[model samples]
Target: MDDNLIFAVIGAGNTGQAMAGYLKLKGFAVRLYDRSEWRFKSLRKHSMRLSDEIVSSQKIDLLTTNLNEAVHGANFIIVSTSTTAHIEIAKRLSEILTNDQTILLHPGRTGGALIFKKILRENRPDLKITIGEFESSIFTTRVSATGSTVHYYGIKNGVHFSTLPAVDVRKIFQILKIYFLKLRPIRMCSTLL
Candidate 1:
């Protein structure tokens, strides 16, 4: 587990903020991005107040806008945005990302990874894409609305991830285990839908 792995978390909403805080605590360089202006503001305010506790001590870097800038050199990209924006975001990211990049879809619902794969294929057929999934995103985490801070109640119950063709599962899991030590790999079945 490399402590220097850079992580870009899209969608600075509740889930995004919670995960960012936790990842920072684990010593990963994390940057956050969101399309919503409100979310961006919230993240900034929270970061400012928790600067000593979350930023200064942990050295977590927070970025609200500029998707390309946040993700350009990141080793891992975590998509925590709503389902409606999933396709568009995936399409935009596919254009800029290289084949070696790893993408994790938090709270990957039915067909989420498949949809991303389809869009990537339509745009960059030659590029190999590998999208992973989790049992749930956030791990029962919550952020306080009053103080605009985060609270991680418990570790993730389980994180289930699978890559296309299944050959890249080990590599993906190895990277994930750094941040999520309790992650459990799910057996692949014919239906990813």
Candidate 2:
């Protein structure tokens, strides 16, 4: 794994927190952001903890309430926010993201990738976008917060990803494999859903 890889997870809810925790355990520098001040404050009180299987004391960098600060320069941006905010967030990111950056959507459902593609095409078509699925939310095993400690129950395997043009599948696979050792790439036939 590349120690230089930086991951920013937006949403800081269960899924976001879990991703940040797991990546941190894997030795990646992770930043977490959420719109909820309450959750942010809660996390602040108790730093996140990874499952027992992995050993690490790395704390996640919290970028609460500031979307741009969380995402602007990240090599990999994982959107774990609710589906309702997906389009709006993607639209905003289209203006700031560069072609080399990747956006991975967790638990993508009902045309989520299509929606992002639509907004990006209409706005910054030149920018590159990649979408993926992480089986389900990363914290599925078990997660509970008390004071400043967020505890996790388990971690799973295999994250699937695909690039917008499909031709860049290899590149996407290469980047994702660094953070997720078990990533599987699937090629899509069309850009439209």
Candidate 3:
């Protein structure tokens, strides 16, 4: 378990920042990414706010504006942005995603996962990548009063996750349980209906 597994959070928004900080707090290697370089400056601000909660000097492994740098070597990439941008993000990811990487929308909208998976398949027929989506964001989050720290308001239980290639459910769950203890794998067939 000590093998440095990299977790990349692909947005710098409230949900993404909190997720990344909490993951870093939990001792996982984390990389934070946003298209804007200015958003990358969040670490210096978040680290201080999370200091009391984490009780240790946990910090994100890297922060970058380049998507390629963010996803490279990341075992799992969480697309924490709003579902509105899933298509655009999917297009970008299809271009550089490696075969070994797995990506999932933090909170999937109707048919969002399938749409994303379809794009990946069409673009990279040569690669077998795992894709999935959560029923909703695991953490209800917002920036703190200080305006730098992401404050998690709540954790909803029984949150469902549906992955592509239904057979990979167990494998994907094993990966997610490491950080998101609240996730429960549900039938992809059932969710589609």
**Estimated TM-score per prediction?**
0.85, 0.84, 0.88
What tens-digit string does per-residue lDDT give for candidate 3 at 20-43?
A: 878887778889888877775646
| Per-residue lDDT over 26-115 for candidate 1, one digit per residue giving the tens place of the 0 to 100 score | 777898887766655545554523332243323349666788977888888889887888888988898788777778888675667788
Backbone collision tally, model 2: 4
Residue 125 displacement in candidate 2 (angstroms): 2.4
List clashing residue pairs in candidate 2: 45-148, 46-148, 46-149, 47-148
lDDT of each: 0.72, 0.71, 0.78
Candidate 2, residues 111-130: lDDT per residue as tens digits? Answer: 67777878888999677666
Candidate 1 residues lying further than 4 Å off, grouped into runs, are: 45-59, 190-193
Instruction: Mark the regions of model 2 whose C-alpha exceeds 4 Å error after superposition.
Output: 52-56, 133-135, 145-151, 157-159, 191-193
Higher lDDT: candidate 1 or 2?
1
Model 3 ranges off by over 4 Å: 42-48, 51-57, 145-147, 190-193
Overall local distance difference test of candidate 1: 0.72
The order by descending lDDT is 3, 1, 2
